[model samples]
Each structure stands twice: as structure tokens, then as C-alpha cells.
Target: MHQTRLRITRILCMIMITALMVPLFSGCASKGNSDADKGQTAQPDTQQQEEKVEEKDPVTLKFPIWSTITEDLFTKLDLVNEYKKDHPNVTIELELLKDTEYENTLKIRNAANELPDIMPLKSAWLVNFKDNILPLDDLEAAKNNLFAADFKVNDQILGVPESQFNEFIWYHKSVFQEYGIEIPKTWEEFVNAAKKIKDGGKYIPIAMGGKDAWPDYPFNEFMPSLVAGDGDYWSAMATKDEPFAKGQPFYDAYVKIKELYDAKVMGPDPLGVGFDQSKLMFGSKQAAMIALGQWFGSDLKSMTDVDINDIGAFLLPVRDSADEPFNTVSMVDTFYTIPKTSKHPDEAKEFLNWFFSNAWYPKYMSEAGLQSTIKDVKIDLGTMFNGAFDVSNLKYVLNKGGNEDYKKIESTIKFDVKKMGQDMMAGKDFDKMMQDMNNSWKNARSKLK
Candidate 1:
């Protein structure tokens, strides 16, 4: 008994000694991380002593944004309350604006050299203001390593991409199934399907808001990809100095539009309606389907509460035979830039560096039905994103690189052709209308240097 007691007591003492020494050894190890420590280079993820050595009071930064994003996401205003377990000194000012007013208002501000410290500018607008914005490349931690090679021109890092957004043709699966309709695999099929839906005493097949030039994007810029047969042809059109209205591709596309309109496929009074009206048409089950971004997933579900299994999507089908239908548009989803006039450039950049890298940012975006530009993160596809389609913005653009010429068409031939389309829908002759569009483009292109 005495011998056993001695052995147990010895073991207990050793354990106690080990327990106390562990923390001491850990502290020493952290202090000894230099090369001399050899093999002790790695340390535990505990707070670094350097972080504690010189902590400054948190700096408040104002971030102006246009979206109707909730204040719950303003971490700076929350001051990392959940994370730091206390209020942060940084406060973000949230600025919301209607879509129409956002860009124009920013442009006005830009003219006066007044832009927000952090402003979410549309991608195309970024091209005009690239010089006024600060580049994120200089920050060591902020420099995105994954897509390092992608950073080009003027050292601009732009803003981190938020979500997978694709322009797609979506159909109501249940409605299609009830009508025994197959999803359209070609543009002709799409038009024919619309006619069938209309003949069945259903509302016209597609809804649109033509007043907003943006909604016209699909028909103007994207639909041409179908007629041009591939992206390369579209690119050629961009550099040709001849307007799109001069080409066979442009002619073929307008012909398709005429076919749909002649078939009475578009909702009656499409030009008279607004975006919400069209959205309501699809949401309230008045229209069969529409082409729009995947971000509409949340709104559609909210408006209808339809089962996830019932929502269906497919890329816009090609009109002519081709290797593959160009499935996406390569536009920048959205961007944020530091303006030259910002009062706190360095601070704003610091905040963005932390903001983009924050783990919560990705979750917040996913919850809000957005995709991130940052490459490392993956979506969990929670209740919201599950079965909600998304595609990589990068791949989407590259695939459409062959179709970039389509964009030039909108800037060049769009107004004239759309005017002609309006006349055609009013029962005008196709050839005369085509000739008018070609003449308009010829006149306009000659004005350019």
C-alpha cells in the first residue's frame, strides 16, 4: 500500500508541473520565433503581442453606398461590437439612392470633384473615373493573390466582386409542364413557344420595360450575339467603323424581333410598362417567363413563395446553329472606388481592406443574393441561394469576349434600329426600315474621328 501511494503521488506531481509549464512554454515559444528558435516558427493563433503592443483608437470612416442594403451590415457603425465585444470608433455613413439617380448624381459629384470615400460605381462608369479612384494594389494584405494576374491597367484593383450574376431566360416550370412545353432550345423555339402560349389564351409570352435603356440591354447588346453566331463576329463589328445596322447579323437579329412581335409574343403594350410592371407580370403568374439576372432569385421567391423545385432557368438559346450559344455577358457586376477628393483615403482603403477580407462579408453577400469578386470563398447556398442559379462573372465575360461587338451596336445602331422596330411593329415595311437604320449608322459613324 505504501509503495502504491508513492507512485500515485509522483504521477500527480508530474501532471501538475506539466499543466503549469505549458503556458510558460507557449509564451516563451512566441518570444523565440526568430530563426534561432529553429522548428518553433509556427505559433498558436492566439492574439499576437505586437497587436497589443501599440493599439490605436479605432478610426471612424464614412462609406457611402447606393443600394438599399440594411444598416445591420454597417460593421463600422456597429464598431465590430460583436467581434471586439465593444463599440468601434469607426462609423460608416450609409447613403441610399434610387437606381436612376445613383449614377447621374455621382457624375455630378465627380464634376465638382466630390465623391464619397467609398462609392459603389457601376462598372462602365468606372472606366470614365478610373484615374480619380485610388488603386488597392499598394496595400500588401489588400492585394488579392488568387487573381493576381488579373489586375491590369493603371494598377487599379477596383472593388471585390460580390456575387455570381448571370443574365438568363427563366421559365415557370409548373406552367411549362402543364402546357406540355419544352424549354426553348433555340431562339426560334423560344419565339414559337411564346406564340403557342399566346394562342392558348394565356397572356403574351414576354414582359419588358423599354423605357429603361438597361432592360433593352438583352435585346440590344445580347441578342445580337445570337445573330452574329459567335462572340468573335461581334468583336469585329465593334472595330469595323461601320454601324451594326449595316451588317447581316444586325439584319438577322431585327428579323427575329419582327418575328416575335408579328407573332404577338410580347405582352401587349410592352413599351408602355415599367420594370416593376413586368416583374409583377411574371411574379403574379400573368406572364410565362422573362430574361433577367439571377439576383432576382430572392425577389421572385419573396413575391411568389413558389417551391424551389418549380423555378427553372436556361441560357438564351441561339437562333442559328453554332458550337455553343454564348451563355453570358461579361460586364462588371458593380465596383467601389476611392475618389481623389476623399478626405480619408488611407483610412478608407484600410477599412476596405478589412471589409473585403472579413468572413462575414461573404456570408452577408450570400444572404443578400449576391456573389463576391473575391475568388477564395464559396457559397453555402443556404435557403436563399439553393437551386438559385449563379455563374462566375469571370468565365461569363470571357465566353462573351467573342461577342463584345454587340455592345458597340447598342451605342451605335440601337436607337435607329429600335425606332425602326417600333415602326415595324406598327406594320411598316422591313426593307425600308432596314435601309433607314443602315443610313442612320452610316451618318453617325462618319461623325466619329
Candidate 2:
């Protein structure tokens, strides 16, 4: 009986051990499947995130033009790239060419109707090819800016206003101090200063390059302001059926230029000198000053002996007693335009939107001494103007409707000013020159009708 009992007990123990092993194996298999299911569930979210990243990336754009290869351009390009991050669909390709060559090539392309999709157009040419360019009139991006009034052509807007460059008289502070001559505040003061500097026998008062012909434009912009005064003088001259050359302002200005010329205020070979040489003449202390744009600040910074802080600037002095003391002519530095034959007009438009809306531009452009077009974009005036530019009062007046019909008034002025310049250069009979210019403009207006 005892042997039989031992046999049965051993069999029972073996059967119990087999049962435990089976359940343990089953538990292991169940745990493996749970892990596999979790991994399968996470895969879709990871894949979706990658797809979202790709969708948000920007596309590349190719811009064909040549500009100064400076730190400013590089900063602008970098800002463009940052703008693309939020708008991954747009990319920019910079095609830099020599200045003269680029201008020639663009003219050729324009004539052949093979112009690039986007181009930087000069404002002077904007009116000539109004049909070939896209009007930014209805562009939600451009309509709400100060430039809207300036960039309009007849009933259409032609281009985006990038920045304005103002011309000023660049004088060497050291030279002024050494000679003990004050910087002129009025037209008479300026002439007197020039005479005093000439008498000192140190250097000529002005360094001008007549060979280029472009320098003549500044003189044109400057002299008229002195006689006509800045406030709609051109318009008054234009509408009165008065001749540009015959006007008191023109006569006064011509007399001044003749005085400057006869007194030898400018260098002897002014006509033979080029723009760079003129600046160099001033930088090397051969000339006391040069009348040019704000860009001269950058040129002078490159010279070892010349400190930019030592270079002082002043507005062209005006003769009208009641007018503002400082008179200026505004110049558009760069204007943005889209060609009529662009394959990617929508893309270009979208990129401009991104550029203007992005905050990176203000930071980028300001770092390189450029102004931003975006209204909210505030510049540290201390840095940009370097305490030289103080047009705070003018800004206030413009905002307060100082000149409500300023545009129409300014157009007439531009025509007279340009004609006055050409006539003076040609030595035409001053009275006849003014009369012809006025009638010519009157005829131009009649044709516009």
C-alpha cells in the first residue's frame, strides 16, 4: 500500500510543474504583442511630423541684377533667407554684374522682351515702360505706405519704394576748423564760405566731376532749392506759364553758379575728374569738400586719414526768407518691380509679403545702414542718422497735412528743375529756356488729357 501511494504522489507533482510552465510561456507571448502594438501606434505621428516640416519649407527664387558687393547686400540676402524659413517655398538667387555692364544688359533684355522675372528699376525709367511692369497699386503690401504717393504713374503704381537717398554737402571738419570758416547756413553764407576757403589757398571749396554728367544733377537739384525754395517753387513756376530760365529763382541760382565758377570754387580739372577721383581728392585733403549723397559717408569711412565723424554734412541753403532753412531733393535708392513675363509672379508676390511682414528685415537692414519700408519698423536713429539727420519736425508736419496736394505740385517742379538744369548746362538764353520748358510741360499736360 505504501509503495503505490509514493508512485501516485510523484506523478501528481510532475503534472503540477507542467501546468505552471505553460501559463508562464503564455504570459511572455502576450507581453511581446503589447509592445509591438505600442510601436505601431507611434509610427504615424512621427511620419506626420516630418511631412509637416517638409510642407512648411520655402521655395527658391532667382533674382538677376548687379549691386554693390557690400556687407549690406549680404545682410539683405541673409534676411531673405530667414524670411524663407517661414515661407519655405521661396528662395533668392543673386546675380551680380558690373554696374555699367548690368545696366547695358538690362536695357538689351528689356528691348528684346527677355527681361528677368523681377528687377530693380530706376524711377526715371518707370514712366517710360509703364506697360512692361506690374503695378503695385492693388498690392495689399504696398498700398498702406508713404511711398504710395511717390511711386504712382498717372492712374497706376509702378514699383515698390525701397529707400530714399538724400544729397548733402560733405565737408571736412578738420579743414573747416583749420581755416576757421563756419559751415554755411544760407546760400549767401555758403558762397561766402567758398570764397573764404578759396582765399586761404589751401584747397578748392568743392570737388565736382563734370565728365560723368551725373554730378550736374545734384547741382541742378541744389541751385533751384536755393532760389525757388523747397515749397512747390517748381509747381508755381510750372503753372504760371512762366519760363524756368526767366524766373527770379533761376536767375538768382544762375548768378550763384556763375560766381562759383568764376571764383574757382571747384577744382581746375573738375570736368576731367570722375566720381571716385572727386571723393579721393577730398579724402586726401586736396579739396575741402564734395557735394554728394549720403553714400559718401561709406566712402569716407574706408580712408585711413579721414574719420567719418570728422566729415560734416549740411543741406543746400535756400534764399526764400519764409521757407524752411534746409531744402532737400529725395532720391529713390532701389525700387522693386516684377516683369510682365514672370513665370512665378505669385511666388514673387508672396515672398515680398513675407519679407515686409518679417521682423528680421528691420534688424538686418538697419545693421547695414539701410532703412526699412515697413511702418512698424523703427530704426535706432542714433545709429542710422548718427545724430546728423534731424527731420523730426518735418515728419510731424507731413503727418499733419502740411502739403495736401503736394504730389501734383511736385510733378510740375520736377519738370522745371530738370529743364533749368539742362538749359544752364547748354548756356541757352535764360529767358527763352524758361519759356520753352514751361510751354513744353504745358504741352505734355495737354497730351495727358
My TM-score estimates for the predictions, one after another, are: 0.70, 0.71
Candidate 1 Cα outliers beyond 4 Å, as residue runs: 1-62, 69-87, 139-155, 225-238, 246-251, 304-309, 322-326, 380-448
Q: Which ten residues in a row have the lowest lDDT in candidate 2?
A: 395-404
Model 2 residue 230 lDDT score: 45
* Candidate 2 structure quality by residue, lDDT tens digits, 245-294: 44467556766665565566776666677767887888887888787765
In order, what lDDT does every prediction score? 0.59, 0.62
Provide the lowest-lDDT 10-residue window in model 1. 391-400
Choose the strongest candidate by lDDT.
2
Compared with the true structure, what per-residue lDDT tens digits does model 1 show for residues 29-119? 8777755555444342234554553365565555555644334344434434532333244556666677768878878888988778877
Cα lDDT of candidate 1 equals 0.59
Model 1 residue 39 CA deviation (Å) reads: 32
Candidate 2 deviant stretches above 4 angstroms: 1-60, 64-66, 69-72, 75-89, 97-107, 137-144, 154-156, 222-242, 248-255, 320-325, 357-359, 368-372, 381-449
TM-score of 2: 0.71
